[model samples]
Target: MSTVFWAIVVLGALIFVHELGHFLVARMMGVRVLVFSLGFGPRIAGWSRGAGETEYRLSLIPLGGYVKMLGENEEEDEEKDQSGHPVVVADAPDSFANQGVWSRIAIVFAGPAFNFLFALMVLVMAFMLGVGELLPVVGSVSRGMPAEQAGLRVGDRVVAINEQPVTRWEVLSQTIKRSEGVPLRFTVERPEGPILLTIQPRVQEMTNIFGETVRTWLVGIGPGSGTEFVTYGFFSALVKGVEHAWRMTDMIVTGVWKIITRSIPADQIGGPLMIAEMAGKTAEQGASSMLFFMALISINLGILNLLPIPVLDGGHLLFFLIEAVKGSPLSEQVRLQANRAGMFLLIVLMAWAMKNDLTRIFSDG
Candidate 1:
């Protein structure tokens, strides 16, 4: 099915880009990678490659991939002379753990960086292929809806919300969603002309296509039907692609901030189930649409990985930052203890997200 294919394709590309970051950086840092695998678990097909003892592979599981750099675990390799302390590889140039803090940091951070870049590439490509922004036109207004009550009519161009100019329909939607039930002063351009309206949103339970209910503040307005695929010049695509990535990054940052600040509900969290659902549907639409979603998710992945929580790149980065400030790495004992703490925290977070996802998935039905 197209959905399954797209889901797999997106997940595969994401894992590949992430692993590629680690692999390339390891190579650059002179670390010997034992294996660069496109998937996890038992290898279905693989082979060792030029100048390294590592196997470049396609494994059984497509969910994840890894770059198994030499000296990564420090427990597996045992080439000691007399004592239990292992002998260091003096000959092999590329060893991940052997690299300095900055190099290691760079290697770790590259995964997320590449994801963002990949997303940017997708956005730029879509734009170059002629993706048009949605027009600012009201789709529906409930009889007693805020828009109707405030005299906001159809075919109105929503120029601004709370005096903040919105150039894109996407921006307008996001602004309204995050307004926190405030009485929003919207500058709408009706057929007769522009007018300011104080539109108040009420908390309403809305059912999605999946039959899941979401309690959201509704402003009772929607953008007009359809978007045109507007092709772009190569240069413009590149520039716009980066802008798209930056915008996504910003949105993710703000969303996280809002969650932490209690401006948004904790139930809004999601995990793989939500993502896979989106990916499956998006993939069926075609490359351009899939690409758009991929870029969005890439930015999501990038930002998510950067959260300073343990068992994540951000957690590792946080440790590195502390090491940088302290003029030495955290003690192995401290690192291990912190890691345990992080692992616990990460599990809790995942559990929460998964719980929310499950609740949303089943409750409406």
Candidate 2:
């Protein structure tokens, strides 16, 4: 029950933040917003404000939300009310369709931008509040592994890898993974003093939580049991937050490229179920953990929406770019077909993710 609740809360807040971007931008650009809805499908409950200018709705479906603007459908000059009465929309001066290509593009791009900004804010807060992280202290080593063969003891603290300083376990793990099978110089601090050890990571196949086998480099050393809470000052936290968000964006882009190039399996993609489980587990860890998780998800959402796929913000921006270059918008028929294709692709992708989620659930059970 708590998982379901948190999932809804997290997803709902993200969606709202995304849609709010479009809503605010549209209004700022003089486009009349007719409805600001929190969800899709039939309206469960709502109230109108601004003298019925905008209808604020909480709909039955919780999966997604949208902001409807005047003349959003280019073919429609007027919108109908609940009574099926034809209501005249605002004039072309204030209609979304009448706006310049750049304005429309800005409105569309704002959604993804807001998601990234929200992630930055959340990360900053998490850093300020102090999040627990694993240090680079080796607690155990496999007897036959590369680390053991290199004479790395259990009490040795890894200070650097390949001349690059690494203070956290994540950095160390990433460094090892990127090394492939090449020998890396490991700078360690032992009880006596500092020592350098050259170790080549062993390439091994490992099954992830989703039961997908992925090949990764391994040194077979684990971090110590306890975690250290790392906190930063205001300016440092802001800088770190921005850096973290950028790193996440880069990682997601690389991951997507790998998937497209068939370097990563498509079945590794996760959906709502995986998010819910992660949310619950993180919430159990405490507020800081949950906030960090939310920041990660927000970054993911921002990057995913920015992909140059039709039916997404990136797709809209692509159209605007073409319009800007060609000095005119694409043909209505072409746009319609592209949107349809995009929607089809999105549905297929969602179905595939759901299948993977279910497969992992039953396999774990």
Candidate 3:
């Protein structure tokens, strides 16, 4: 029950944020919106300020939501009879179809933009609320490892590597991994005084979380149980939040590329069940952890929507780009076929993800 609840809460909130972006931008661009729905399928409940106003709805399906605007469908602007003659309809000034190309692009792009913005906001809050980080203190030096050979002992607190200060374990580990087997100078604080030691990292074969075997440099030192709740002021948090979001975006983009190149297994893709499981686990960890998880998901959602595939915001932007270049919209038949292909691709992808999720569930059981 807890898992299901948190899943719904997180997914629902993100979907609402996405659709709200389109709604606001469409209204601002003078497009008349007909529906603002939180989900798909039949309307569960809804309200409107008055007749012909945009009807806000909670729908039966929770997988996704959408916003409907006047003249949003390009097909509606054109039709043909059995005799193969073009039938044209008058365009409404406030309809989406009648808007300028740039205006339409802005309205379509708003969904992903809002997602990124929401992620930035939550990350700032998460940082302000304090995040737990492991201090760069060595708890144990592996026997026969480079650290042991270099005389790095237990209780040694690393202050710097090659004169560069590292306060957190994550930074320290990444630095070591990227050292490329080069000898590094480490400055550690001892009871007597600070000591400088030179140690060379060794290339070791390791399996990554993706089940791929890869080689990386390692010193074989583990962090101690020294953790601190680090908090930042408002301005500092804002800077950190932006940096974090950028890092996440880069990481996600790289991951997507890897998957496309077959560097990562396709079966790793997951669907709603996987998200629900993760949401439940994070909620149990605490609000800060949950927020962090949400930020990551929000970033993922933003990047995913920006993919230039048909039936997505990115796809619409692609269409607008082609129209701008050609000085006209694509033929209605071509747009319709492209949209159908995109829809088919999405359905297959969804089904594959669902299969993967169920496989993991049953395998775990």
Once superposed on the true structure, which residue ranges of model 3 sit more than 4 Å away at CA?
74-90, 180-182, 191-193, 213-215
Task: At residue 77, give the lDDT of candidate 3.
Answer: 44
lDDT of 1 by residue, 228-291 (tens): 4567899988988877778778878887887788777777888766777788887667667788
lDDT of 1 at 281: 82
Please give the lDDT score for candidate 3: 0.90
lDDT of 3 at 117: 94
Q: Candidate 2 clashing pairs?
A: none
- How many clashes in each candidate? 12, 0, 0
Q: Write the per-residue lDDT of candidate 2 for residues 85-186, one digit (tens) a residue.
A: 875553457888788889999999999989999999998998999988899999899989999999998878899998899899889888888886999999
lDDT tens readout by residue for model 3, 101-123 = 99999999999999999999999
What CA RMSD would you report for each candidate? Answer: 6.1, 4.3, 4.0
Model 1 C-alpha lDDT versus the unseen true structure: 0.79
Better of 2 and 3 by TM-score: 3
